[model samples]
Target: MNCWKTINISRDYGTLRLIMFSSSTVLLSFLFYYLVMSTIVQTTEFTQFGFVTVVLSLFGLVLTHKLLHCLPIWLFGGRAKIKISTRKLLFPLMDIKLREPLSRNVYLLALFSPLVFITTAGAVGSIMWPQFLPYFSILTSINFGLAFYDLVYASHLMKAPKQCYIEDHDEGFHILIKQAV
Candidate 1:
């Protein structure tokens, strides 16, 4: 099947909405760090290695997100495929495409697994490592900020018709609802 033939659902989701949504993600990420880290740790000092640690931590966070998103989708058998789309530029966008459409509930489960685990882990890490608060908060914010796109797609999917299935693309998703026979 030519995947290109499937409908690109992002067009209908509105640019303004996405912009606002993405901006909110970034704002919240920063605010969350400010609120949590500021109150708990008054000051933090970091050397050059701290910068390196932030970079590495970012890479790890993205990998963790991808792993969480991919594992559940792949669990649906071999119908799922992972592809890298350069359209995301330096971020290295990863898309999980499924040949078979899954139920809305299943898709939601796969989508949120990363957010749930990663956010919780970040909170715990931040609390445990007050000395490395900057690093931890930066890593947490980056993870959440980068996940803006995921939140967008999830927003669309959440409103999709019950029978519709979603196929993730780097840019957006294909919402497919089987036409009446």
Candidate 2:
């Protein structure tokens, strides 16, 4: 196999830029989702959870989003190592390292699973329980923010050859293609 390209989005785009993009995504998604849901469900009742509860719930959402990324790979018989650690002694971080490369389609599926699943569930929940729309919208927006990096990685992968394989590395990911004889 030939190494086609190496993509390190954080390095290429800069961590600050990526963080800014993700912050914007969270705010914009929340605004858009809240507006749409509010119109659909004309209820003025908004349930507010406690500050500690909200923080813990958001943390759980982040963990769930990370697990969703691994779900597809697990189903495809791939092995991954998940590391959970704390950043700044407060924020939790989860890193998943793949034991083997995956086909372009499967890798894309893994990258997108969190966004699709969480967003869909949030939408459905908001519609069913309008009073919790704020919470649902916040969770969904946060998921989208977390998925910003995944979306960037997917764009690069999508441009690679369809037969390519994606391998995660400490830097980012390596796109490999089979050599033609």
TM-score of each: 0.72, 0.91
Task: Give the whole-model CA lDDT for all candidates, comma-separated.
Answer: 0.70, 0.88
RMSD of 1: 4.8
RMSD of 2: 2.2
Against the correct fold, how does model 2 do in TM-score? 0.91
Residue 21 local lDDT, model 2:
98
In candidate 2, stretches whose alpha carbon ends up further than 4 angstroms from where it belongs are 1-12, 87-89
lDDT of 2 at 130: 90
Off by over 4 Å in 1: 1-8, 11-24, 40-48, 76-78, 85-92, 169-171, 178-181
Specify the poorest-scoring 10-residue window by lDDT in model 2. Answer: 2-11
- Candidate 2 structure quality by residue, lDDT tens digits, 16-134: 99999999999999999999988998777788889999999998898899899999999999898788878678666789989998899999999999999999999999988999999
Root-mean-square deviation of every model = 4.8, 2.2
Worst 10 residues of 1 by lDDT: 1-10
